[model samples]
Target: MLRFAPSPTGDMHTGNLRAAVFNYILAKQRNEKFLLRIEDTDTARNIEGKDKDIMFLLNLFGITWDNLVYQSHNFPRHRQLAEYLIQKGDAFYCYCTKEFLDQKRELAKANHQAFRYDDDWAELEKDKNPHPVVRLRAPKEQMGFHDAIKGDITFAPSEIDSFIILKEDGIPTYNFACAVDDMLYDIDFIVRGEDHVSNTPKQILIHQCLNYDKTMQFAHLPIILNEEGKKMSKRDNASSVQWLLDCGFLPQAIVNYLVLMGNKTPCEVFTLKECMEWFDITKIAKAPARFDIDKLKFLNREHFKRLNEQDLAVLLGYKDSAIGALAKLYLQEASTLNEIREKVDLIFAKKGLLLAQYKESAKTENAEILEFESQVKTLQDTLLTMLNQDCSKTEFDTFKSNAMQNSGLKGKAFFKPLRFLLTGLAHGPELSDLFPILRLYLKDIVRN
Candidate 1:
C-alpha cells in the first residue's frame, strides 16, 4: 500500500501537492493500494473544513485514492500500542510534573545546553506523579536507512533523546501514531518531504522493537523553497489552490509544473494520465528547488497552446473571433490567462490613448522616429487594403511580407512603431495577429 497523508492544519499548498503527487504516481506505477490519510492528530491546529480543502486540491490535480483514513480515528489503537510497548519494556512512563519539565527545559536553555529528559522520571513512584506520559526508550547504537531519493543516510543515536509518544492529553504524538498506523495497515511504501527524515529512525526503532516481520520502502523528497530561496509557507500563497485558480492558472499546468520541480527532465507539460505513466521517484533530486511563479505561468501557457481555438477563447471569456485570434497571438507567449486579458483590455479601451508617448528610456531619437514615419508612409495604401480584407490564421505572414517589402524596414524598426501605436507596448501578442483586431479602430491610429 501507498499513502498520501497531509496534516489538515490549513489549505493544501504547492509543496503539499508535490508530496501527494509523488505518492499517487508511485502507487499507480507499482499497481499497489493507494489511500488518503489525513494526519489530523494535532487537533489543536487542524482547521475545520481543511480536510475537504485537501480533497478538493487532490481532485483538481487529478490524483485519486481508493481509501480515506484519518489519524484521529486511531486514538484507541495508538493508546493500546503505547501500553503494549510499556509492557514490553520498549517504552516507559515519565512521572515528571509539567512544572519540573518546564523548569528543566528553562535551565537547559539558560545554560545554552540541549534538554534531554532524565530517565529518573521512569523510576519515580506512580502515586506521586499519577498523570505520566509514555516515552520511547531509544537504543544506544547508531542507525541508518536507505532512502530512494537521498541514498544511504546514517545518524548517531546520541542525538536522539527519550521522546514522548503518548502525551498527557491522551493523544499520540505524530511520530508514534504514524508508525503504528502504517504498521497496522500493512503499508508497502512511504513518501514524504525530507523534513521528516529526522523522524524516520525513531519510527524505525519502534518497528524493530515491535518485531515487525517486514520492512517498507521509503522515499524522502527535498525541500521546496520560495522563489527567494526561503521556506515556502502559507504566507506566500493567498489560499493555496484558490490563489492559483484565481490567477487563471489551469490545474493541469500546476500538476505538470510541480512534478517537474524535483524530476530530472524538463517535460513541463503533462496530463494526470501522462504523469502516472512517466513519473519516476528515483529521478527526483535531493537538492532543494525554488518555487518560481514565472515558471508556473510559462508552463500554463504551454498547456494553453494545446487547446483548440474555440476552447481557448471560451477560457479567456471572449466570443469575438477577431479578439479570439488577437488573444491567441498574445496567449502564444503569455504565462497566464490574466496577462492576455489585461493587455487585450487595455488595447480595446474607448477613451485610452492609442499612440503611446515613447519613453525616453526607449532611446527613440527624433530623427529615427521621422525616418520610421517616412518609411511607413510607403505602406499606408497596402495596410489600408489589408484593413478591407479578411485575415485567415496564416494571414500574419502575408501582412508581414507586404509591410517588409513596402517599407523595407524589417524586424524591430518596422514592428516596434506599429506595436507601440496599436498596443502601447514594445512587445505583445504578434503584431500581425493584433492588427486584424486593431483594424477595427485603425482610422483612429492612422489619423493620429
Candidate 2:
C-alpha cells in the first residue's frame, strides 16, 4: 500500500502536490492500493476546512486514493501503543519540568554540543509529578534503512535520542503517531519529500522498539527550488497549486510538468493515465528539481491546443466555434487561456484608439493629427454603410478596397487607421483573416 499523508495547513504547496502525484502514479503502476491520510493530529496548526480543500485539489488533478484516514481518529490507538512500550520497559515516563529541560538545552548550546535528553529524570517516582511525558528508551545501536531513491542510509545511535512519544497533554508527537499509524494501516510503501529524512531514523526506532517486523519501502523525493536556487516556500505566489490554477494553467499540464521534473519520462507531454503506464520511482534523480514557470507555460499551451474547439470555446466563456477559432488565432501570441480571452474580448469591446499616441507619432513625422482622425472617420463611415447594406456578403478585401477609395488614402496611412478602428490595437493578425471570422459581429464592430 502507498499513502499520501498531508497536514491540514494553509494552501497546498506545489511541492506537496508533486509528492502526491508521484505516490498516486507509483501506486497505479504497481496496482497497489493508494491511501489518503490527513495528518491532522497537530490540531493547533491546522486550518479549518483545509482538509476538504486538499481533497478537492487532489481530485482536480485526478489523483485518486483507495482509502481515506485521518490521524486524529486513531488517537486511542496511538495512546495504546505508547502504553504498550512503557509496560514492556522499552519506554518510561520522564517527570522533567519544562524549565529544567530548557536549562539543560541552553547549557548544551553554550558548550557547542547537541542536546540529548538524559534518562536521570525517568528514575523519579511516578507520584512526584501529576503530568509527565512518555519517552522511548532508544537503543544505542546503529539504525539503518535502504531508501528506494537515496539508497543505503544509516544513522548513528547518538543521533537517535530518546525522543518524546506522548506529551504531558496526552498528544502524540509526529514521529510516534506516524509510525504507529503506518503499522496499523499496513502501509508498505512511503513516498514523501526529503525534508522528512531526519525523522526517518526516529520512526525506525519506534518500529524497532515496538517489535514490528514488517519492512516498509521508502522514497524521499528531492526538494524543489525556486528560480533563485533556494528552497521554494509558500511566500512565492507560484508555489501554491490554487494560484497556478487561477493563472489559467490546466491541471493535466501541471501534473505533466511536475512528473517531468528531476525524472526521466517517455515524452515531453502526457496525461496522468499515460504517465502511470511507464513511471518508475527508482529512476527519479536525487538532485533537486527547479520550478520553471516558462516550461510550465509551454506545457500548458501544448495541452490547451489539444482541446476540441467547443471545449476550448466554453473555457473562454463562449459557445460558438468561430469564437474558439478566433481565440486559437491568438495562441501564437498568448500562452494562457486568460491571455487569449483578453485578446478576444478586445475584438468585441468598443474601439479604444490611442489618440494621444497617434498624435505624438504624427508630430514626430511632421504630419497633421487632424488628417489621421479624418481618415479614421472616413473608414468608419464607409464600413458602417457597407454593413447597413449587406453585412453577410461583406468581404474584408472588398471592404478595404471601398474604404481606401472613398478616403483617398493608401497603404499604412489607410490600413493603420482602419485596423485601429476595428481591433483597438496598432498591430495584430491580418485584417483579411480576422474580418472573416468576425463577420457575424460586423454590424456591432462597424457601428461601435
Candidate 3:
C-alpha cells in the first residue's frame, strides 16, 4: 500500500500535486491500495478546511486515493507507541531547556563538533524531573539502505542525531509520528522526496523497535527545482497549481511534465491511462530536475488543441449564459444556437480580437489588403470551378500552374494577405486549408 500524506498548509501547489500524482500512478500500476492521509500533526501550521481544497483539486486532476485518514485522529495510537518505546529502553527522556540546547549548539559549532543532547545527562535529567522529552537512541554503527530511485544511500550511524522523539509537550515529533502511523497502517513501502534521506535510519530504528514482521522499502524520488536549479517552493511564481490552471494548462499536461521530470522515459507525453501502463520506479532519475514552465505550456497547448470542442468550451469557461448575449445579436442570421456558437467558438479559439475588426478590414480600400482579399476570392472561385466541372488531376494541375504564374507571388505574399483578410492575422493555417472553411463566404457577396 502507498499513502500520500500531505500536511494541510496552504493550497496544494505544483510540488504537492507532483508528489501525489507519482504515488497515485505507482499504486495504480501495481494494482495496490493507495490511501490519502492528512498529516495535520503540526497544529500551528495546518490551515483549516484546506483538506477539502486538496481533495477537490486531486479529483479535478484525476488523482484518486483509497481510505482517507487523518493523523490527528490517531493521536492516541502514537502516544501508546511512544510509551512502549520508553518502556522498552529504545527511547529515553531528558528535560533539556531551549536555552540549554541553544548553548550546546553554539559551543559545538565553535569547537567543530556535531551538536547533540548529552546522553550522559539523560539519567541526571530524568532524576531531576520525572517528565522528560523522549529521544530515540542511535546505535554507533553505520546504518544504510538502497533507495529505489537514488541507489546505495548510506549514512554514518555516529553522525545520526538521537533527537527528541517526543517533545516537551509530550506530542510525538514528525519522524516518530510518521513511523508509528506507517506501522499501524501496514505501509510497507514509503515513497517520498530525497530530502528525507537523513531521517530514514531513525525511522528504520523505530520500525525495528516495533518488531514488524516485514521490512519496509524506501523509495526517495528526486526533488523538483526551479529554473535556477534550487528547490521550488510557494515563493516561486510558477510553484502554484492555480497559476498553471489560470494559464490554460490542462491538468494532465502538468502531471505528464512532472512524471517525466527526474525520471527517464522514452515517451514524450503521458496520459492518466498511459501512466499506469509505463510506470517504472527503477527508471526514475537520481539527478534532480529543474522545473521548466515552457515545457509544461507546450504540453498544455497540445492537450488543449486535441480536446473536443465541447470539452474545450467547459475548460475555457464559456458558459451558455455568456454566449446567449451574442446569440441575440446574430439571432435572425444564426440557424440555431449551436451554429452561432460554432462561429464564436472558432473565432475565439484562434484569436480574440474583435470580430468586426476582421470583417471591416476585409472590405478595406487599401490596395495591399484589397489585392490580398481579391486573390483569395479568385482562388476560391477557381476551386469552385474545378469542383463544378469535375476536373481531372491533369486539368486541376494546369489550373494550379496557371494560377500560381498569374499570382506572381509565393509563400507569405500569397498566404499572408489571404489570412489577414479572412482571420485578421498575417499568419494562420495554410491558404489551402482555409479554402474549405471559406467556400460559403467566398460565394456570398454579403460576407465580402
Candidate 4:
C-alpha cells in the first residue's frame, strides 16, 4: 500500500500536491491501494475544513485514493502502542521538568556540542511525579534507510536521541503517532517530501522498539524552490494550489507541469491517466525542482489547445461553438482562460467601446480626433443597418470590401475603425481570420 499523509495546517502547498500526484500515480501504476492519511495529531495548528479542502484539491486534479484515514481518530491505538513499548522495557517515564531539560540544552549549547537527551531521569522512580512523559530508550546504533530517490541515507547513533513518545497531556508526538499508524495500517510504501528525511530515523526507532518487522519503502522527493532558488513557503501566495486555480490555471495543466517538474518524461504534455502508464518514482532527480510560472503558463496553453471547441467555449463561459472558436482566435495573444474571456466579453459587452482610449491614440490636432470619432460613428451606423439585412452572401473578404466601398474609406481609415467597432480593441487577430469565427455574432458585435 502507498499513503499520502498530509497535515491540515493551512492551504495545501504545490509541493504537497506534487507529492500527492507522485504517490497517486505510483499507486495506480502498481495496482496498489492508495491511502489519504490526514495527520491531524497536532491539534494546535489544524484548520477546520482544511482536510476537506485538501481532498477537494486532490479531486480537482483527478487524484483518487482507496482509503481515507484521520490520525486523530486513532488516538486510542497510538496510546495503546506507547504503553506496549513501556511494557516491553523499550521505553520509560521521564520525571524531568521543562526547566531541567532546557538547562541541559543550554549547557550543551554553551559547550558547542549537540544537545541529546542523556536519559539520566530514566532510572528515577515513577512515583517522583504523577505527571510524566514517556521516552523511548533509543538504541545506540547506526540507523539508515534506502530511499528510492536519494538512496542509502544513514545517521550516526549520536544523532538519534531518546525522544518523547507521549506528552504530559497524554497525547502522542508526531513520530510516535505516525509510526504506530503506519504499522497499524500496514503501509508498505511511503512517499513524501525530503523535509521528513531527518524524522525517518526517529520513526525507524519507534518501529524497532515496537518489534514491528514489516519493511517500509520510502521516497523522499526533493524540495521545490522558487525562482530565487529559495525553498517554497506557505507564506508565498504563488505556492498555494488554490491561488494557482484562482489565477486561471487548469487543474490538468497544473498536474501535468508538476509531474514533469523534476523527472524525465517521454513527451512534453500528458494527462494524469497517461502519466500512470509510464511514471517511475525511482527515476526522479535528487536535485531540487524549481517552480517556474512561465513554464507552467506554456504548459497551460498547450493543454488549452488540446480541448475541443465546445469544451473550451464552456471554460470561457459560453455555449456557442462559434464563441468558443472566437476565443481560440484570442489565444494567439491571450494565454489564460481569464485573458481570453476578457477578449470575448468585449465582443458581446453592452458598452465596450473606448472612445476616450481611442482619443489618446490621436497624437495630432483635436480636429483630427473629432474627425476620426465622427467617421467611426458614421461607419458604426452604416454597419449596424447593413448587418441587420440578409448579409448571408457575405464572406470576410467581401464583407470588408462592401464596408470599404460604402464608407468611402480605405487602408487604415477603413480597417482600423472597423476593427475597433467589431472587437473593441486596437489590436488582435487579423480581421480576415476573426470575421469567419465571429460571423454569426457580427450583428451583436456591431450593435455592441
Highest TM-score: give the candidate number. Answer: 4
Off by over 4 Å in 3: 123-131, 319-448
Q: What TM-score would every model get versus the actual structure?
A: 0.77, 0.91, 0.74, 0.93
Scored by CA lDDT, what does every candidate get?
Answer: 0.77, 0.85, 0.69, 0.86
Give one digit per residue, the lDDT tens place, for model 2 in 295-396.
999999888788887888999998898888787777777888888888887667665345556666666644466777777777777777767676566788
Q: For all candidates, what are the clash counts? A: 0, 0, 0, 0
**RMSD of every prediction:** 5.8, 3.0, 8.7, 2.5
lDDT of 4 at 301: 86
Candidate 2, after superposition: displacement of residue 3 in Å? 1.5
Between 2 and 4, whose TM-score is larger? 4
Per residue, candidate 1 scores C-alpha lDDT tens digits across 335-379 of 677887777665654222332334244466678766655544544
| lDDT by residue (tens digit), candidate 3, 312-426 | 5554356533333332333233332243455445433322233345558577667865565566666544444544542333332354455455555566565554344344445
The TM-score obtained by model 1 is 0.77
